[model samples]
Target: MLNTFSLVGINMGGLKISLLGSLMCIAVLPACVGLKPSVEEQVNARIEAYWQAMIQKDYEKAHGFLSPGFRLKVDKFVYRNRFAGKTSYKAAAVDGLSCEEERCQAAMILEYTVHGVPPYGFEFNRTEERKELWVNVEGEWWLLPKK
Candidate 1:
């Protein structure tokens, strides 16, 4: 039987086939490209923000970036008491900072002179310092204790 709903030179059977193919292509289009931001980019931004804040000694700013459990583990007062007052020893530079998924760690090289009295006198020294490890939880990151 000949159908009246034919497309151009093609018969009805071919027209139905072409329509189905077009529909399938449209359905699969979204899977071919991404619309959301990449996880790696998000993680890297978090790491940079944390690093900058720490270097600036903006403890509150840095603390705001931490995960909830970590924030509770040590309050603002404790953080200030532990790190705020101490003067920087100087000659320290961040050697490396890397992050993988929810975890990050950094290394620093410190160069200074050890001051001594009497026998030892003052001497120059250089050493590599390692910062504590950090972890992310529920989209927030925090520094873990050194072991």
Candidate 2:
């Protein structure tokens, strides 16, 4: 009793074993090698995107990154209102991150430029490190905004 199959366009017979198992392994190797990013990478990517949204002043977009729990409590209108008229975000970048299980803390640097304070025509640039917590909920990483 033997099964026949083709491998690399070559037909082989009289072998009791099929190359199907080998082919399946080869097809699935990429998944084992991580077709999707690791947890840390996912959190880091989300952190970067969240800051980019804030930098773009797309509060609605940034709001989308907030944890589901937070979103449920704060509507987009309130979230968007929190940033209205006050301008400070010039740039943002993820500096470091640590993760364990379903939680992560991301350290980011926020850049700012402020003008007309104390002096009528003086402007200043500032940068600060900000830490944000991210959590995995329903297999998706989202920012955990402080309520």
Candidate 3:
């Protein structure tokens, strides 16, 4: 037979546990909310950084943006060589980006000056639009290899 005082103490203990649990959730919930940038923003930022690295001829840094699967398929040497001696762009912009779950696609526009041969020598500005694929792996976004 439990005494009245003992029953009251047990009830208080349960109440204290419940109160502590609720307080813990209250303290932790906000920190988990809005702690990271949205997926679209993150993808766009990563793409921007990749283009910047390329423009600066930092092949090693640009290679870091490639997806793990892509990197596995194509080593850094091959990746760098592909872009070596490529046409240089005067400006680049990420026109738009859309994300769905773990995958994202971005549209980019690059502006460059095309130089003609000496005989027909003429310089003209050209713009090209490209679609890029990206994937999110373990919370970090990476660009997929070009097909």
Best by TM-score: 2
* TM-score of candidate 1 relative to the true fold: 0.47
Model 3, 1-147: lDDT tens digits are: 000001101122221212332344345633236566456656755776787677666787889999999888888888787666544445556666777999988776666555654687777656677888999899899999685
TM-score (C-alpha) between model 3 and the true structure: 0.66
Q: What value does the lDDT take at residue 91 in candidate 3? A: 55
Who is ahead in TM-score, 1 or 2? 2
- Write down the lDDT that model 3 would get: 0.63
Clashing pairs in 2: none
Return the lDDT, model 2, position 13: 28
- What local distance difference test score does each model get? 0.48, 0.65, 0.63
Q: Assess every candidate by TM-score.
A: 0.47, 0.68, 0.66
Q: Hey, what RMSD does candidate 3 come out at? A: 20.7
True-vs-predicted CA distance for residue 24, candidate 1, Å: 40
In terms of lDDT, the poorest run of 10 residues in model 3 is 1-10
User: lDDT of model 1 at residue 124?
Assistant: 43
Say which candidate scores most in lDDT: 2
Q: Please give, for residues 5-62, the per-residue lDDT of candidate 1 as tens digits.
A: 1111112221232234224434553322554434433433454455456546677776
Residue 131 shift from truth in candidate 3, angstroms:
0.6
